[model samples]
Target: MNLFSDIRTLVIDNLNAMVAEGALPDGLGFDNVTVEPPRDPLHGDMATNAAMVLAKPSGKKPRDIAEALADKLAQDPRVSTAEVAGPGFLNLRLDTSVWQTLPSAILGAGASYGQSDMGAGKQVNVEYVSANPTGPLHVGHTRGAVFGDALASLLDYAGYDVTREYYINDGGAQVDVLARSVYLRYLEAHGQAVAFEDGTYPGDYLIPVGEALMAEVGDAYVDQPESVWLAEVRSFATDAMMQLIREDLALLGVEMDVFFSEKSLYGTGLIEAAIDSLRDKNLIYRGVLEPPKGKKPEDWEPREQTLFKSTAHGDDVDRPIMKSDGSWTYFAPDIAYHYDKVQRGYDLLIDVFGADHGGYVKRMKAAVSALSDGKTPLDIKLTQLVKLYKNGEPFKMSKRAGTFVTLRDVVDQVGPDVTRFVMLTRKNDAPLDFDFDKVLEQSKDNPVFYVQYANARVNSVLRKAREAGIDVDDATLASVDLSGMTHDTELAVARKLAEWPRLIQIAARTNEPHRVAFYLYELASDLHTLWNRGNDVPELRFLQEGNTAASQAKIALARAVSVVISSGLGILGVTPVEEMR
Candidate 1:
């Protein structure tokens, strides 16, 4: 079903045949041979770099190999023409029938047409939006959440067993700060005036948590000392914050398969075990870290502490696992978390972090590398910041979160589908602008609307065709004789359809979900362009009066386009609108 892979196989097979014919050297590696869309469409439907890659290795001129290969490829029925282009690149133009047959192939596969086995059932754990469990998620966390969810779905579609995970950062001192914040609110609820210290949370979101705490204990801890209430309140406040976090994620239609508690790593021998694994490899040591480059933090006093030789595994510097105060550092809990992931038998680990967490990427990768002894690879994807705007001006922050917009603020403004799609309009590592006015605008400028419009328009075609006494259901249209779809515009849509399987493999292999968004936009654009062309050429219209046969063929093409759009949107966690509202 993968047309590109199919062409690659053909190229490889012919290379073997060339070996048998003694036209090329024996046992030449074909791994370098790749069949991809030409950089310029006018070059050909596809191009290969086989001759160029093999020229130096075979001690033969690339043009000579390309010329011979072109002659042999032209003999294949699917290959209409083949020519050796500049520098031994071979460009191929496929037969019209080859493109025409793609719609039927897509119909046969339904939504599973572009599914790939590249992942080969590898187990992948994706951790994302693991923001501190002290407040609701914000726009920064939203980008990471959407990116991670889409990536997990992409890997799943590519045949990897993926587990969505959220690391609750509940064991840190920040949760203690949250407890104090909630206690202040609790005092406020009991009609006692309280002031928020600079380090304590001052968001109104904690007001509800305070009220609930007051309701639960009924002033039992109202006048108690810090030792008696701090522990109990800290645990209660963390659970409340996590509840808020979960609700925020749900607003964006995200659900995690695992919620790992950072506290679980403590008092469970997990942290010691993770450090012990590194110690066995002589990676753990006690040493004073060098003064950080440039402006170091004010607390940068050089003190000997337990450290991990992270530099050995490709970090900027060795990282500390325990502070000088005999307590595990923040990095210590993280190491244990990933070590647990390694112990869970996952073949791969992926962490989708906020752009601000870019500093942690190298150290985390180093930890996973050391813990797994380079056997398992960890990929850390940092989603760049998302800037919010409305009415062409930078959107201001929510008073509740104080300095940033919360995730729910976005979902409530535009539904989750809009939020998720707009967040992915750019590369994960590139900054994005989420404008409420722009994204919700009913124009081509909004990708979600354009893609959904294409699907809805396809459904309209089906409705009109069926009303005209033509059976337009998938089962009926798929059986229609689609050979009449020979116009260049009609065939162009089919050509895009042919790229579906190939596009999936590329995006999946690169682990880039943004490619899927780009592909869907291009596919929708092609369909829309064809529609605009039909406005002038009545014969090209999808529906023809008293000509159900031709209409069915055109409608079948539209249905195939819808199939690809819907499948791509499914990967993006967006529902394809069946009818435009």
Candidate 2:
């Protein structure tokens, strides 16, 4: 159970009683009332703004209302003291029993302790790692892949129906370029000299695709014209590149529920249908955009074009949907893609994009808004760059990727768990520095190691207890009497455990999975603090010698920490280490 929510309910019940007794006004809005941990722990265990928020509304002094509210709250068995702080704030100190019993509650819930129904089962489409199918995924796409996959898992934990999706950028001229590059490789496989001129991929990764093409049709397309091989090779090369990308993602433990092809939108009526839907709403028009700011009039010429009135939906300006050559502009297919998402009946849409695509955020949001008529909410999260370092110096690029570090390069060096956790150590919008030497260090400064160490320590405690002939299973520990757990340090760790459910709701509402990583670190810190304190105070140790009763109660708390850590790491797509090697 959520202790914070339980206490908030207690606060509201007392307020309603005060209103019934005519001590407060009949109708004071309780929506603004909130109960949270006090800013300074020295003040109290929890603080509420019930008195302060209702004072002006009820036309009564805050202190007068606080005093009456305090009397009502103090009568409850859970609250030990309810005192009025500065101006009308009410600070509460819960009974020691409240904190002592939290371990039992945590054990009872197990890994589902922090799972929330905040989303109420709404369908959410999360599109991420939609990198061009031109080559294997690079380091930048790795961050987006981790962030998006973790977000989908987080939303799932928060009770949202999540769909992990990847949009393939295979319809553009880039595929044609890939085909030509593979043709050069094919020529090389046929023992012919070839040069990769401008606008063609020169990476050795495509050499295999060229060799495979020669093996598939031996000497058939040798010295053939462009028309004879362009379409066939484009399709073949796109599949190969996609396969490489999928393998790279698999290396990092990411799997997508759908792989949407942008090519499907072409040679079909889907694009026209999406544009016509907007046309029916008077959002499509033939107009000429004004010259961009800072451009001299003599340096530009106006050209009338088919445009979408994106300004009506929140874009900075109207955007062209068709070029002067009468072909669809880049933004048209994007609109069609989003329109298809809206028609799929999803309640929410979330796109994880690279930081370079920040400018596309507003236009994409505008498109979804116009398509869904502002019904379906869309949130675009932009993942920033990751700077790699080795021994405090900048790391070199991957030879396989040619110009950038591949996802497999990072995963192979540090393994998937370290790579995923380090990627999420920073906020998505903030730049992250991944230091190879520092992340693997087994010290408190290394959050991943510290957190994993805490879990490992819990496993050690369980093993010791079991060897000592003390029953430490969840059912037995949950039922153990915890009245002796009155040490200040012991109670502090329990207090942190009580915050898990509340933190889950906050992180889910804000769509920030990084907060989960941060909370796990804090929880791990509290656990380590208590574990170290036991050395000075022998009686505070989890395995109490010759006392099976006391040992089970103490070990219960330690095991509860592992349960929460496992749940948190699971959401981050990192397997919890039972024993850190």
Candidate 3:
């Protein structure tokens, strides 16, 4: 149950009663009213702005409305006290019994404790890590992959019908270069010496692809012209690279629902169909774009080209759809891809792009707006770069990838759990430093370790209680009497537990999975604080010397913390450790 939502409903219901009694006006919008945790725990359990937001609309003084609302709220069995704070704010302290019920509720619900119906099963398509199928995923792609995968899981937890997608960028020049690179490797397999020029890929990962091609066809395309082999080899090379990419993603436990090929948009008139949808609205036209901002007149030339009126929908300038040679621009394929998604009847579209694609954000949004006639909403999140460090120095590049560190390079060094958790400790748009020395340090400074340690310690408590002949199972502990848990420190962890559902709603609404990571860290801190206090205060411990009932009551609290921690880690795509090793 969402405690904050329940309390806010209480405040609204009381306000409605005040109106029925003629103490306030008939018309008032209570949508702006909110009940949230107080800034300082000493002040109260929850604070509401109900009185402050209603005073002006109801034609009453702020303090007068607040005082009246306080009396109505104080009468509830759940609220122990309600006081009018400065300028009409209302602070509320909940009854200890209210906090006591949370552990039982959490145990009853298990991993589904914080699952929300906020999205109401809206169809959401999340496309991420759509890297060019020329090589294995790198560190930058790793961040985007982790972020997008976690986000899709978060939306699923919030009741959205989410489809994870990957767009294969094989309709570009890069794939042709990949085919040439593989051909060189194929020649090398055939006992011919070759040189990898400036444009072709030089990574050793392609050596296997080349050898495979040699094994498949046995030198049929050995000295053939570009005309006979370029197209077939391009298709073959793209498939191989995509296989490598799939393996890389599988290593991180990411699976996609769709893999759309850009080439499908080229031959089947899909791009034309998407462009025609815009033309029907008079958005597609032939226009000469002004010279780019910092260009000299001698270096710039004006050309009339097929363009989309992207600025009409909030882009900085209009964007071209076709080049002068009648070739589709890079944005054209992206527009068609999103158009395909919109046509599939998705209610929302989310694109996770690399930070280098920041400039395409507005134009892509504008295209979706124009194509969907402002019906479908597109949100693009750009994941920034990740700097790798080991032993306080920058990490070296992967020889397999040749130019940068591959996703396997990071995962192999510190397992996928640490890799995924450490990737999300920072915001998506902010730069992150993934240090090999720090993330696995087994200290409080490592968030992943600290959070996992909390869960491990909770299991230890259960083990000790079980050895003491006390029933510490979820079924028995959930029915234990928790009314004896009145200490402020003991109740603090329950209060934090009550915030899980609210936190999930906020993070899902904002499309940010990092918030879940942050909340888990804070929840872990609260659990750890209570566990540490048990060392000196025997009554605060999870195990009681002689009283089995008291031990079960305290163990219930620790078990509840692990339930939420496991759920939160599930959303972040990390496996929770049961025992510290």
* Among all candidates shown, the one with the greatest TM-score: 3
TM match of model 3 to true structure: 0.98
Count of clashing residue pairs in every prediction: 0, 0, 0
Which tens-of-lDDT digit does each residue in 1-581 have in candidate 2? 88888899998998998889998889788998888889999998999999999999899999999999999899999999999988889999999999999999999999889888888999999999999999889889999999999999999999999999999999999999999999999989999999989888888899999989999887778899999999999999999999999999999889999999999999899999999999999999999999998999999999999999999999999999998898999999999999999999999999999999999999999999999999999999999999999987998988776778889888888999999999999999999999989989999999999999999999999988888788889998889899999998889899989999888888877789999999999999999999999899998899889888989989999999999999999999999998878
How many Å off is the CA of 439 in candidate 1? 0.8
Q: Candidate 1: RMSD over Cα atoms?
A: 1.5
| Residue 64 accuracy (lDDT) in model 3 | 98
Best-to-worst ranking by TM-score: 3, 1, 2
Top model by lDDT, which number?
A: 3
Clashing pairs in model 2, backbone N/Cα/C closer than 3 A: none
Report the lDDT tens digits of candidate 3 across residue range 464-540. 87787788878887798999999888899999999999999999989999999999999999999998998999899
- Mind giving the per-residue lDDT tens digits that candidate 1 earns over 103-161? 87788788998999989999999999999988889999998999999999999999999
Tell me each candidate's RMSD, in Å, in order: 1.5, 1.5, 1.1
The lDDT of model 3 is: 0.94
Model 1 Cα shift for residue 421 (angstroms): 0.5
Quote each prediction's TM-score. 0.98, 0.97, 0.98
- Residue pairs in collision within model 1: none
Q: What is the lDDT of residue 362 in candidate 2?
A: 93
